[model samples]
Target: MLKSNIKTLIVIVGPTAIGKTALAIDIAKHYKTEIVSADSRQFFKEMEIGTAKPNAVELAAAKHHFINSHSVTQLFSTGDFEVEALKVIENIFEKHDQAVMVGGSGLYVNAVVNGLDEMPEIDLKIRAALNKQFDDEGLEIIQNQLKQHDPEYYEKVDQNNPQRMIRGLEVFLSTRKKLSSMLSSTKKQRPFNIIKIGLNTDRAKLYQSINLRVDKMMENGLLEEVKSLINYRRDNALNTVGYSELFDYLDEQVPLDVAVASIKQNTRRFAKRQLTWFRRDEDIKWFEPGKPESVINMIDQELKKP
Candidate 1:
């Protein structure tokens, strides 16, 4: 009844703190296959507690790759992940017909599953210049440039986010090609079939889970983790939500309580953005986080599709 003809990549995706890791492990174990992590934060070795990495029990549940595989010092871009993750998946299919990829990072997931556009990399000088212009002229100047250059992306991009706008401008400047036009608008066909399972909960409930998770992270010594990495605070890798907020506390710019509350609020915002990104993928099938059995059943059905 099953095709038995193609390998399958079972992608477990959801907002942060929504239990993707546990579900991915359970599913990987069921298939007796390995897991490839797409969570960008979890890739670095120095960041453990703040990133909410899998506990020893959860990790020993199944084999995983890309966890603690890089250092904050490394400039591991999404392009790097696409190449490495595909290799990992190829090795997985050598031993099993299925493998699980799990993460809250939408861009990294998209990079592996859909493939990034083959755009030329911009020089660091260009990026630094753009950043300086952004700081000096404010976003309106850069926004106007993007509007002039890549009006299509300008319309779709989040206008409030300078990073997105600057990236758009960077591509336009680097190649004179619209970042929108260079996107992998046509999804790349892979050798394997992909089955995407999205886990979501009531929005309010999701926010509450994030808040609680942050509290647990603090209890687990997120502040101490930031303290250890204080020297590397200038690194772009360390400029993330949890660590950055705690870094602010360390800098004496904000009190500890304020930093904790800010982490919860910023994490909720990040989760909302994650949901927005994953929701755009029409291929993903959604389920309540409580009903992982339903997800398993869906995967069973998909694996049998011809």
Candidate 2:
């Protein structure tokens, strides 16, 4: 049994389509606590089908925070999320001793678990120039530049994300320092105890799941949803895998079938990247997605520590 005075934050993390959401809900219901979403893609109100957000049934099962809480036009950085999520967790703690946080966005998850690093002040003009370059020369130009300047970060970052590529380039241009070098390894201490759980499976099975998910999204009108957001195609939020590929189809840059194939391919690559990021954190305990009882038992054991 958990102590009455102890407060714990159960962090659920894994690759996309790996059952993080279902497991998170189970844990939240078991602990009788609310959920704090760390998924950056699910924060936008306009993005629905493509983001694979929790359905009505899941949301009804447990109270959730930060889902559909921001607009695509809003500039909600990781630092902004860190501040807001901590407040949400604090609020949940007022009513219950535990809160659940879950997402596949490694950066956002890390922001809440370990505070963001202090970045050097970047010149507004530098960012403007980068954005102008992206508009005129295309993301390829900016991506190649970022790759040349900061190859370490280039390897890990989602190459499809223009905003991320631009940020890395702008930091190097403004400070003459690689963004990867500036990222400190220090983790900030949080007031509440944190138990991190990771879900994963064999690569072949995971890829099959991702492909099936993309097909399901198409069946659920992901193309129509992407069409509705075409006017905002340039927005950073729409530059993601599913939306971007469809945008390419609308632009006559690729066939619909080709676009769908790209989405699956990119999503599989994204899952690989998520694994790379989370594996670096030695605190996380891994489990197969099929075994929830083991995860709960492990969490119960960890809660008894110290």
TM-score of each: 0.88, 0.96
Backbone clash total for model 2 is 0
Candidate whose TM-score is highest? 2
Model 2 per-residue lDDT at 153 = 77
Candidate 2 has what TM-score? 0.96
Residue runs of model 2 more than 4 Å from their true location after superposition: 1-5
Clashes by residue pair, model 2? none
Residue 216 CA displacement from its true place in model 2, Å: 0.1
Which residue pairs collide in model 1, if any? none
Local accuracy by lDDT, each model: 0.86, 0.91
Q: Give the alpha carbon lDDT tens digit for every residue of 1-306 in model 2.
A: 233356999999999999999999999998899999999899999999999999999999999999999999998998999999999999999999889999988888888888889999999999999999999988999999999999977866678999889999999999999988866468898888888999999999999999999999999999999999988998898899899999999999999999999999999999998998889889899999978889989988877776
Off by over 4 Å in 1: 1-4, 121-125, 131-166, 173-181
Indicate the residue-level lDDT of 265 in model 1: 88
